[model samples]
Target chain A: MAIVAQTSRFSKIAWPVVAWIVGLIFFFPIFYMVMTSFKTDADAVNPEFLFSFTPTLENYANMTDNYDYWRFATNSIITSVFATLFALVVGVPCAYSMAFSPTRSTKDILMWMLSTKMLPAAAVLYPMTFLTKNVLGVFDTHFLVIVVLCLINLPIVVWMLFTYFKDIPKDIIEAGQMDGLNTWGEIKEILIPLAWGGIVSTALLTFIFCWNEAYWTVRLTTIDAATLSKLIEGNRAPEGLFFGRLSAVSTAAVGPIIVLGWFCQKQLVQGLTFGAVK
Target chain B: MANRTIPRILQTPAVILLLIWMLVPLSLTLFYSFIRYVLNSTVRPEWMTPSFSNWRGFGNYEFVLNSKDFWFAVKNSIFIVTSILTLTVVLGVLIAVLINRSFPGRGIVRVLLISPFFVMPAVNAVLWINMLLDPVLGLQGIAVNNINTLIGGLQDAPIVGWFFNMWPVFEPISFRATQTSSIAVIMMVTWQWTPFAVLIFMTSLQSEDQQQKEAAILDGASRWSQFRFLTLPHLGRPMAIVVMIQAIFHLSLYAEIEIVSRGNGNKNLPYLIGEFANNNIGAASATGIFAVILANIVAIFLLRMVGKTLME
Candidate 1:
């Protein structure tokens, strides 16, 4: 009894402390980046002022003049928002059909869509560039980035919507149909409200992905319509200085998404795991 | 069930979009692969433009197969993917278990733990390679230098002075080196993705049979045995899901590798393909086909598992 009591008491303290320490350790790098952002570039690399430097807003202040930060920031916002909207616009109807009225090949179609995602972007890199640059002439344009983002995320968007739509009872939709509602009406008036939470979270996750997408956005864009990902990748080799400005830009790039992510951590698991775990 | 037309119409747009997205570029790649295409060949400029006249059946494939770089890239891609998979899963399980129980500030802990997942890959690579893993300029360098200075000062102490003097000076390790570049990629990717694995495993943990766990406790099972026997078995499916999901992501990892060392000695298949595309379009296309095959091989298992999820 004493041993059990002692072990229980020990664990009661041990587990929480361990969890907190691990959490802090994991968060330290991000914290360091944010902290470094407030230092001047010179002080950023100086060990003498490591933890005691005078924090400044000089880096963020000169962001636009120094790196053309706003252009990239605007491009990121435009592409991500439009891509998320387009994906949902296309995905909802497809998921609705699969959920409410699955056909003989619905399962196959869903699997096939997921399979498309597994297609490596690199495999078609040359062709995509060739087609966009020479044939289609949409290279480095917002239209191209938006379309690419929507296409790549469309499968996951559809899958997420399908999973959410599956949870709604068919009887509800049938009743709505009996009440003289068409398919569009059913989706807008009935299905959406029922799955509003799922749809919003899906959009959030997709937007986050489009924002963080480094591969196509980098490869397709040179100067026009480049994103924050392109900004950081271009400036990857800072040559020992510019750490302050770099951190500021990175913080700006990821700050909104991380906060958004904190709100939807639960949905993230459900979406990424394909509702399999639950 | 009532009518197939509208449903098919609704799905048609999606189908057609993906079909074009998948087929058009890929077919172009396939066509280019069969031709002896190159961007700049002063000796044989006729090979510049892709044409039927330049058709070289099986030649590009044979060239790719014979290349030593191709084998190194395949080996490295597999190594990076497997290393990252093992690290994320093991660390995910441990961290998920650690924070499973209700505790003080669990919400904040969860926030901090999961923050890394939201970091952009570009930022993750830049932050790690420049600010954290840099041998002379990063935090690791500064910390290592601090320890050495501390040791140097300690050499004057009375009792431990001799021990301190005997201790060798420490040197900070550079991750940008040929051999260690992939290790940097692995570390940063694991940091970003362990949170993902943790989130999935935590969700899975929540759905575990509490009553069965209690029964094990009543039957006098140790914590380790209870975890080993009951929890591990329950987590089997989620582990597989984590492994395959990560495999899908890490197989084509680019920004991280590019930023880390420009694929110096740690070239993966995708990096190899990128290198070839700079001049040798035919070789690039052939390598892309190989990558597609490799991807499909990993993806088949995941498709089966996900399809079954819906069937249930």
Candidate 2:
């Protein structure tokens, strides 16, 4: 009994310490980046001033002059917001109908949508470039970025909305129908109010995805519609020369999305796994 | 009749959009793969445009298959995906279990852990390669130098001098090299994604049956046995979900590979495709088709698992 008691007591202190250590280790790089942002370029790479450097806002202040940070940031905001709105607009109705009155083929259709997500974007890279640049002449436009982002994220949005909608009892929708509400009225009045939480989270997750999207946003845009991802990729080979300013810009690019991510960590599992795990 | 028709109408726009999104570009790729095409070929200017007149049948596929880089990219892709999947799952399970219990600052711990998942892949790559892994100015270099300095000091001591003298000087690794670039990609991606796996596993853990665990304790089952039998089985479904979802995402890993080494020593199928697309449209299209085929094989199994859970 004493042996068991001693071991249990030892574990009680050890567990939390271990957990905190692991968490700090994982977070150290971001913490270091943020810390480095306050140093000058010289101090950033200097070994002597590794941790004791005088902090300055020069990196953040000179960001615009150095990188044209605002232009790219504005582009990121415009595309991600519109894409999220568009995906929800298309996704909600599809998920609503499928949830309320799923037919035999509903399952297959849902699976097919997900399968489309699995199609490697690299394979279609040339075709998309050719079509947009040559045929449609819409390359590097905000509209093109929005449409591509929306299309890529539409499947996840629908799947998330479907799972959320499935949780609401069908009796509510049926009652709305019996009240002489048409499909549109049922969705607008009843379903929307009930699944409001789910919709917001889905939109939030989709927005985060659009913001962090690196491939299409980077590949498709050159200057006009390029997001923060493009800006960072363009300056990728800094070779430690501009670590301070680079960290500042990179921090700016991902800071808001990381904060936003905290709120929807719960929804992320459902969003990414299609609610299969839960 | 009206009921089914309205539901179908609601679904039509989404279905049709996805269909067009999937088919048009892909069909173009398929068409291009069968033809002789190049963006710039002064010797064969006729081959520059995509047309049936430049039909090459299976020749492009043959070319991609015969290329040495194509095989290396395929092998490297498999190696990277599997390494990341293995590391994330192992580390994820341990961390999830570690924090699963109530502890001081648990909420803060979780937020910190998950922050990496939200970092843009480009930022993740740059931060790791230049700021953390650079052999000269990175933290790795600084830390290694400090340790070697410490060892040098210890070598002047009396009894510990012999031991310190035997210690080798620590040298920082350059992750930008061809051999280590893929490893860098795997490291950064694993750091970014372990949080995702941890979050899912922790959620699944919350739903585990406490009654079974208590009963196992009453039967004198050790901690390992209880976890192995009860918790491990409970985690099986979540584990599968993690593996499949990650496999799909990491198989097409691009920004990380590009930013890490610029495909210097590390090139995956997507990188290889991007390279080919620079000039050889036919070979690029053929490689793209192969990438699609690879993704589909993984997708089919994932879809089957997801379908089983659907409509339930």
Candidate 3:
């Protein structure tokens, strides 16, 4: 008993120290990014000022002049927000039907939706470009960006919403139906009310995904509909020269989404896994 | 079922939207793959436009297969994806078990741990390549410089002078170099995803049966035995889910690879496709078809595993 207790005590002390180390190691890059953001570009590269620098906000202040940060940010915000809303508008009804009234093909359909997500975006890049540029003539427009973002994310959005909607009791929706509520009334009044948490979390996760999405968002649009991704890519500042302003802008780009992500950490597991883990 | 008609009607919009979304670009890709398509061709100007007359059956497929870069990209893609998957799952399980028990500041620790996943891939690659792993101007350089400085200082000391003199100067690794850029991508991706693994495994851990665990304890089972017998089995489903979902996502990884090496020498399948799409639409289309086949193979396997549980 004494031996067991001794080992247990040792483990209790050791585990948290290990946990702290792991956490810090994982977070060090982001921490370093934020830290470097305060230094001048010269100081950012200077070895002596690596740890203890006289911090400044000059980079952040010049962000507008430097990167045209707001335009790209607004574009990201506009596209991501509208895209998330559109995905939800499309996803909810689809998911609700599949969850409540699953057909023999419903599972196959859901799996098929998921498989579309695995289609390498680059594989279809030329086709998308050719279509949008030549046939549709909507290249580099905000509408194109919004539609592309919404479509790219639609699969995950539907999958996540399906998983969430599955957890709701069928009796609740049925009871609403029993009360002579129309389908719209049943969805708006009962289903949405009950699945509000799921919908909100799905939206939050979808928004994070949309904001962080890089491949299509970067490739599909140029100047007219360029989001923050294009800004970061265009101004990547190779060779670590502009660590100060680069860090500032990178932080600016990912900061809000990361904070928003903090709120939806739990839901992230469900969203990422399509609720398989949960 | 009056309610059923309305529900099905409501679903029509989403279904139709996704159907078009999936079919249009894909059919175009299919069409282009079979045709001798090129964005620009001076000798044969008509070949520039996609038409049935331009069709060259299996020619593009042969072009991609014979290309050295395509094979290299396929191998590198598999290498990077497999390495990340293995690292994440192993680390994820260990860390999940380690932090599964109640501990002080566990919530805060989890929050801190999961921070990387939220970071944009572009920012993640930039942060790692510049700040953390830069050979000369980044933390790696600073740390190496500090160590060398410390060694130099010690070399002047009387007793430790001989020992310090014996030590060779350390060199910081340049991750941007050809062979190591994949390592950088793997490192950044692993860091970002281990938390995801931990999150899933931990969730599954919470559902682990305490009574069964206690029973094993009373039966004089060792901790390793108990974990092996009970906990590992419990984690099987989550592990599969993590691997399957990650396989799907990482198989198509692009931005990280693009941002890290700029498709220099470390090109994956998707990157290769992008490279060919510059002018050789035929080769790009064939590569796209191959990518689709690869994805379908994995998708069929994964969907089969989770299919039953998903429906129920």
Candidate 4:
């Protein structure tokens, strides 16, 4: 009794302080970036005004005039939305077949799909460029970004949906089939509703990945289809020239996704690590 | 149940898409690696076009193998990935344990910790390099310069003057330099990913057998011993998952390296491939093949570790 009481007392005082300190330390960089975004380029470089400055919305207000922020933001939305939708459309049927109808080769096919994710994007850079520009003539277009994003994320989407579908008992889906439902009807009426939470989380997670994707988005698109990743990449000032404007643009770029991430924090762990941890 | 047509039809779009996505570019890469191909050739214009007649089988591979930059990039890639994995796992375990128990601000702590993981890679690089790591204007510069000035002032204090004088002036490292840029990349990536590790481990920790832990406690297990025997084992699966997922992500890490170093002094395999792709199509393709091989070496271990569980 005494030992348990002593331990509880010790934990009560120690844990909260440690938790607060850790949280603040982790958040300091983002806080600093937001803080720096209010300072002029000159004040941003000066140590005297590090914490206190004449806070300005000039950077945020002038973002469109200075950097043309909306074009990239629109491109990001168009590509990420369509790409995620495409992945789900393709992934749903495949996951449905594998989940309901198990075979000896199902595991092998799943593993093979995952193996595609490991293929380095750099390995296919020149070939993709050649095909897009020289052959297909779709270079720097929203269609190309959408296609690339869909292909890259399809494996994870399939894996996620498979895991979600596997959790649903075979009886419910089997019963739906016996109730005079066709394949598409079974998916729409039975599977989709049962797995609504999983599907929503999967879509949200896929959107986040598509938005944060830097490599293909930056390399494949120059201006027309350039996403926020490209915007931030192109506007990376050498040193301290425009820290305020830079931070504002960056804040604008990642702000929505981070907020979206907060709402789906629970799903994030399961989605990202693919439930291997949980 | 043995109906093949419906299942095959269902999976066709996915399989065909991935097949083309994988095969088309890779086969082209193979062809380019064999032939003498260049985007430009002033003297021998024939070298500009990719053709079988211009076959230089294995020559590009040999050239890549012989190049010093290729080896450096390989070494640096391993160094950065290994370092980030090690740091994330270690720090992750500690933080996960720290926040595993109920606390007043646990929710807020989690939000703060996980924020870095969602920051776009490009923004992460820009924020770290320009705002935090810059020598003159970033936090490092501001902090170091302040410390130096304070020491300079204390140097005139009669008896303490001698002591302060003996201390040499401090210098802030320019992380953008050749040798240090890799370190910078490693630091920023570790910051972004450690939260991912912590989240996974924490989830796994929540599922740990509390009754078993209580039994150990009643059996007089010391704190260190309890951690070693109970907690560590519980975290094994999560650790493996963390390592494999991080391996896949960091193996092709590019935007951070590009934005931070631009291959000035620090180049990873992906960055090297990018550089080669700029003009030398043959060399880039060969290097791409090498990168593919390196990823496969890591992927084999990853598959063995997680593939079974994923199937289940």
Count clashes in each candidate, considering only residues at least 3 apart in sequence or on different chains. Answer: 0, 1, 0, 0
How well does each candidate reproduce the native contacts, as fnat? 0.76, 0.81, 0.70, 0.76
lDDT of 1 by residue, A18-63 (tens): 9999999899889999999999999989999889999999999999
TM-score per candidate:
0.98, 0.98, 0.96, 0.97
Chain B TM, per prediction: 0.97, 0.98, 0.96, 0.96
Question: Where does the lowest 10-residue lDDT sum fall in candidate 4 chain B?
Answer: B303-312
lDDT of 3 by residue, B1-312 (tens): 444576677678877887888888888898899999888899999989889999899999998999899999999999999999999999999989888876788888888888999998888888888888898998889899999999999999998799999999999998987789999999999999999999999999999898888777777888899889999999998988888888878888988888887846889998998989999998898899899888888888777776766876
The digit string of per-residue lDDT tens for model 4 on A148-205 reads 9999999989988998999999899879878988889989999999999999989999
User: Pairs clashing in candidate 3?
Assistant: none
Interface RMSD of 1: 1.8
Q: Candidate 2 on B160-278: residue-level lDDT in tens?
A: 79999999998889998998998899999999999999999999999999878777777788878987899889999999889999999998999999999784757999999999999
* lDDT at A112, model 3: 80
In angstroms, the error of model 1 at B88 is 0.4
Ranked by lDDT from best down, the candidates are: 2, 1, 4, 3
Best by lDDT: 2
Q: What TM-scores does chain A show, candidate by candidate in order?
A: 0.97, 0.97, 0.96, 0.95
User: Over the stretch B1-312, how does candidate 4's per-residue lDDT look in tens digits?
Assistant: 557678778988998999999999999998999988889889889989889999998999999999999999999999999999999999999999999887777888899989988999999999998899999989999999999999999999887899999998999888888889889899999989998999899999999998888888888887789889999999998898899889889989999999988747689999999999988999999999999998998888877766767766
DockQ of each: 0.71, 0.71, 0.66, 0.73
What fraction of the real A-B contacts shows up in model 3?
A: 0.70
Interface RMSD of each: 1.8, 1.9, 2.0, 1.6
- Residue pairs that clash (backbone atoms under 3 angstroms), model 1: none
